[model samples]
Target: MEATLKNLWSTVELVAVAAHSDVVEQWDGQTLTRAFHWAQYCQHLFHRFHDNPTIRRVMEKQLQLVNESVSVVFPEHTAVSFSDLSRCQHLLLVGLLHNTKLPVSLLRILFDTSSPVNKEQAGYRNVTGLCSSMIECKSACKVLSPLVEVSDVGADAEVQGVLLMERLEALLSQSREPFLDSVLQGCEGAAEHFCLVIAAALLTRKTAAAQTTLEDFLLDWLLHKHSLLQHMCYTLPASLLTDLAKRHVKFREAYCNVLKKWASDMEYSISDGEWFQASTNPTVSFQKLTEHFRSLSEASPSLWEHVENQLNALKVSDGDFDVRGLSVWGDLLSEIHK
Candidate 1:
C-alpha cells in the first residue's frame, strides 16, 4: 500500500507541474485528461483508505500542492493574452481547479485575478467575451463553459452552479470586506461576471427551482450578507441589472426589492445627513443616485412611483435650518422634477 501510494503521489506531482508549466505546449487534451484522472484517483484513495491516516495524510498533502500550483499558475495564464491556445489552456486550468474542488481562498484569487479594471480593458473583455463565445458555441455552459468537459464526473450545470455558490458562501462567511473592496476598487465587472455565471447556471434548471435559487442567492447571499445592493445601485453598470431582470420574473422582483431597500437606506442617510458626508462632493453622489433611479424607472415602469416618491421626499436640512442653501439639493430636486 505504501509503495502504491508513493507512486500515485509522484504521478500527481508530475501532472501538477505539467499543467502549470510556462510552456503552453505542455497543455493539451492529454494533459487535462491526466489531471482529471489523478484528481479522481486521489479522491478514490482518500475514500478507500478512510481508516488509514498514513495514506490519507499523503494524499491530502499532494492535493494541497496541486491547489497551490494552480493558484500560482492561474494568474499567469489569465493575464492579457488573446492567443487562442493560451485561452484554451486557461479554460482547461479552470476545469481542473473545479474538478479538484478548489478551496474558497483560491477561488477568491481566481475572481480577483480575472476581474477587469474597466469594460474596455483585457480583463473585462476576456471574461465577457469568453462567456459570450462559450454560450454561442452551445457548450454545456458549465461555470467555465465546455472548452473543458466534466461530464464524466456527472456534474451538470445546476450542480456546478450550486458548487460555485457554496464556494462563494464560504468566502463570504470568512470576510466580506475584502470582497467588497475588490469590487469597489474598479473591479466592478467581477460582480457582473458572477451574475453572468449564475444566470448561465440557471439556464439548466426548471423554472421553479431556478427562481427559488436566484432569489435566495441574490437576497440571502448577495444583498443581506455582502451588501451588494449598494454597489448594484451606484457602481455596477445598468446593463447587468437589465440582463438579470430579463432572465427571470423572480429576478426582477428581487431586484426591485433591492432597490427598495437601497432607497430606504438612502432616505435614512439623507435624513441624518450621512448622505452628504458620504463623499467629498455630495452633488456627484446625488446625481448618480437619481440617474440610476431614472434608468430603473424606465426599465421597469412599475418602479416609477416608488422612484418618484423617493425623489420627491428628498429633503436635506441641518439641525435648525435647511441645508439646501449649503448644498445642491435644491438644484438636484429641480432637475428631478423636470
Candidate 2:
C-alpha cells in the first residue's frame, strides 16, 4: 500500500511538472481504461493526483459534465482521479496561494477522510490555502456574476470545528490514562498543529453561521485545556490570534510572556549601523510561534484575540518594534496589518 502510494506520488509529481509545459486535452479510451484500473486498484495511492496541474485544469473545464454524470456512470469509481486532484496539498496550495479559480468544495470532504497525521501537517497547509482561496474566489465571483451564489460550500464550519475539537478532546480526555495509543504523547506539538487547523477555519468565517463552529470550539472545547494558549500567541497571525485574546486573561499573559521572551532572547548589536539578531534560530523561533498559536487556540479560548492585539500594537509601535529582526514572523505580521 505504501509503495504504491509512493509510486503514484512520483507520477503525480511528473504531472505537476508537465502542467507547465503542455496540456492534455482529452484521454483516449485506453488511457481512460488504465486510469480506471489504477483507481480501482489503488484508492489510497491515487490521493496524490490532486497535485497534477494539467489534470486539475482539465477537470475544471469539464466540471459541469463530470459533476453530473461521472460518479454515477463510473460507478466503478474510475473517474475519481479528477476529484482526487482537488485534494492534493501541493496542487491545492498552488491554486490557493496563486489565486487559481477552481471549485474546491471537494476539499472539505477530502479533508474529512484524511488521516490525523496528514491532517496535522500537509492537510492543515492545504486547508489554510483552501479557506483563503474559497473566500477570495467567492468575493471575486460575487462581484463578477451577481446573480450566482458565490459560495457553494456544503460543509458547515460548526461541523468542521467540532470534528477538529474532538481530536483535541481525545487528547485531553485521555491525558490521565496511559499513553499507549494516544495522540497526547506530544501534547505541545499536537496543540500547535491544532491551532493551525483552527486558524484555517477561522480565516473563512464570513457569516454568523460560519463563526458558530469556531466560537463553540473555542468557548466550549478549547478553554478546558488551558496550556494551548501560551503556544498560539507567539505563532499565528496577530489578526487571527485576536479572536482568542478577547476571551482569556491567561492567554494575554502568555502572549506578553512570548514577546518578552523574544525581546530578551535577541543578541544586542553594538557596532555602527547595527540591527538586532535573535539568539534562537529564526526557523525554530517561527516554528515555536506556530506551535504556540496552535496550542493556545486548542487549549485557551481567548488567545487569538490577544495575539491580534499584540500584532497590531507591534505594527503601530515606534522604533521599539524591530521589524527586520524577526524574519519569518515580521513578514507574516506585516501582511496581517496590511
Candidate 3:
C-alpha cells in the first residue's frame, strides 16, 4: 500500500465500494488530494498484483473524488444566475472552463442545478453559450435528451461533421418554447458544419444512413414529432430542406415528405413560423441559415436570393410570443409566395 493512498484508504483491499454520500461530503481537502494518489495506486496495483477488478473499483473511486472536489471547490457553478453573474461567479465559470478534464457527472450537476428564465430570453442564450463554450457537446447532449420534445433519429459523429450537431438536433427537435429560439443558432451552425462534411462525403462516395444525419433529423422531426406539419410548413418546408437535400440526393424524399405534410395539414393554421426565427431579429436567424447552407448560393445563381428574399420580407410583429418573428410568414401570401 502506497503511504499517500494508504492513510486515507484505511484498507489494503482496493476492491472498491462506490463512495457513500457521507464519504464524499465529509472528505476534507487533504483527503481529496489523495485522489491522485489513488489513481497512481490503481495503476501500480493493476500491474503489481494483477488485480484488474480491484484496480477498476479504485479508479472509479478516484474519478468520483475528482467529481466531488469540483462541486466542493467551486460550489453552485452552473446553478448560479445566468444574467449579471458576479466576479465570483465569473471566476467559478472560468475555473470550470479551464479544467479540460471535466467529467460527465459534473456536467450533469451543471444542468440539473440550472433553471431557465422564462420572461428573459437572454438568460437562456447566456447559459447556452456557457454550456457550448465549456462543456463537451456529447456530454451536454446526453444530459439534455430527456428535456427534448422528441427524438426518433439518433446521433452520428461522422455524418453530423461534429459531435455537437447531434446534440443540437436533439435540442431543436423539441417544443421547448422559452429556449428553442435561443438554441437554434447553435443548431444552424452545427447543421452547416455537418453539411460541409456531407458535401465532402458526396465526393468520396462515403454517404450512408449514418452519414445523412441532418436529413434524418429533419425528416424524423417532421414525420414523428407531428409538430412540424402544423407549425413548420412555411419555413422548414422547401427553403432549407431543398438546399440540404441537394448536397446528397438520397434525402430528397425527406424534403418532399415535409412539403407534402405541410400541404395536407394546411387547415392547421397559426400566425407564426416553425424552427426559423432564432432571436428578436430575423436577420440573426437568416444569417445563421445562410452560413449553414452557404453552399446553396454557390450551387445556383438564384437559389440563395430566393431564400433570402422570403426570409427578409417577414417581420416578427407584436405578440406575446415565445419565439421571434411572428408576423413574417404566418399565412402571409407575401411571405410564403406563389
Candidate 4:
C-alpha cells in the first residue's frame, strides 16, 4: 500500500509539472485525464484507508501538489481561454471537494482578486463550474453532513461551522450577479442541507461578537440576497426545524432577526412606493411575501411571536397600507389574523 501510494504521488507530481509545461502549447487532454484518473484513485484509497495515518498524510500531500499546480496553470491577471478555465475547474473540483481536508489555501487562490478565474467572462464559467461540481460531489455532502447531525453537535462542531461559514462568506463576497445566480441555482437542490449546516453552525457560535458577524452575512447574502428563507421554508424538514429551535437560542434568534429585517425592508419599500414601482405585479409580490411568512411561521412556531410583532409594528407605522388601488396591506393583516 505504501509503495502504491508513493507511485501515485509521483504520477500526480509529474502530471502537475506537465500541465504547467503545456501552458504554451495545446494542453494535453490526456494529461488532464490522467490527472483526474489518479485523483479518483487517490480519493478511493483515502476513503478506504482513511484510518491509516500514512495514507492520509500522503493524500494531503498529493492534494497540496495539485492545488499548487493550479496557480501555475492559471496565473494571476492572465487571460485564460475557456478550455483552460474548464480544465482548472475540474482540477479544483477534484482537489478541493474530493479530499477529506478543507483546502483553505486553494480557496484563497480562487478568491484572489487577480486570479484568472475571477476575470469577467472566464470567472463566470469557472464559478458556475465549481458550484455545479459542488452540487454533484456527494463527498461534499458527506463532509458537511456531520455539521448538521444532532448526535455530532459539540464544540468541535461549532469550530467546523465557523470555518465553513467563513469560507462560504469569502466565496460569496467575491461573487457577482450572474455568477452569484449560478451559485444560488446550484444550491437549490442542496438547500436543506445548506440551511441545516448554517443553522447548526450559528447555534454553535461561542460569542455574541462571532455570532453577529455570521448572522449579518447570512442575512445579507444567503437569506436576503439568495432567498434562503424561501428555500428553508419550502425544503427544510419540519423535524429538523423543530430540533434546531429546541437546540439553541441563537438559531431561533438568528432566524427571527432575518425575518425582522425582511419585514423592515418590505415595510420601507411599501412606504416609499419602491415595492410597487419595482414590481410589475405589486399584489403578487405582496402575496408571495405573505405566503412565505405564513410558511415560515408554520414551519417554526417559535418564530410566530417575532413575526407577529414585526407585522403589527409595520401595520402601526403604515396605518392601513395601500399600494396604488390594491388593498395588499389589508390582505396581509387579514392573513396574519387568521
Highest-scoring model, TM-score: 1
| Candidate number with the higher lDDT (2 or 4) | 4
The C-alpha local distance difference test score for the whole of candidate 3 amounts to 0.36
* TM-scores, all models, native as reference: 0.42, 0.30, 0.25, 0.35
Q: Looking at candidate 2, what is the lDDT of residue 236?
A: 57
Q: lDDT for model 4, on a 0 to 1 scale?
A: 0.47
Question: What ordering of candidates by lDDT runs from best to worst?
Answer: 4, 1, 2, 3
Per model, state how many residue pairs clash: 0, 25, 3, 0
Q: Which 10 consecutive residues of model 1 have the lowest summed lDDT?
A: 78-87
1-338 per-residue lDDT for model 3 (tens digits): 34534432321111121121223334333333243234343333333332345754554464456435544644532321111111222323344445544444544534433543222232212232334444455666567666754322322323333433344344433322212222332234464333334332232233565545544554453345333332332333233345455554434444334433332233322454433432322222333333333434444656556534443443233242323334323333232332
Worst 10 residues of 4 by lDDT: 77-86
The residue pairs found clashing in candidate 3 are 314-328, 316-325, 316-326
Local accuracy of candidate 4 as per-residue lDDT tens digits, 150-188? 543333334445666665555434322223344345455
Candidate 1: Cα lDDT at 53: 63
Using TM-score, rank the candidates from best to worst: 1, 4, 2, 3
| Best prediction by lDDT | 4
lDDT by residue (tens digit), candidate 1, 1-338: 66655655454444445445544343453444444444444434433554456755665565465445555755432221111111233434454454444344433433443543233332223222333343433445443445544332223434545555454445433232333233233334565444444444444344565455544554444445334544443444555465455555655566656544443343225455544323322122444555555566566655556545544455334222244433343444455556
lDDT of 2 by residue, 265-290 (tens): 54434453233435543423433444
Superior by lDDT: candidate 2 or candidate 3 = 2
C-alpha displacement of 202 in model 4, angstroms?
A: 6.6
TM-score (C-alpha) between model 2 and the true structure: 0.30
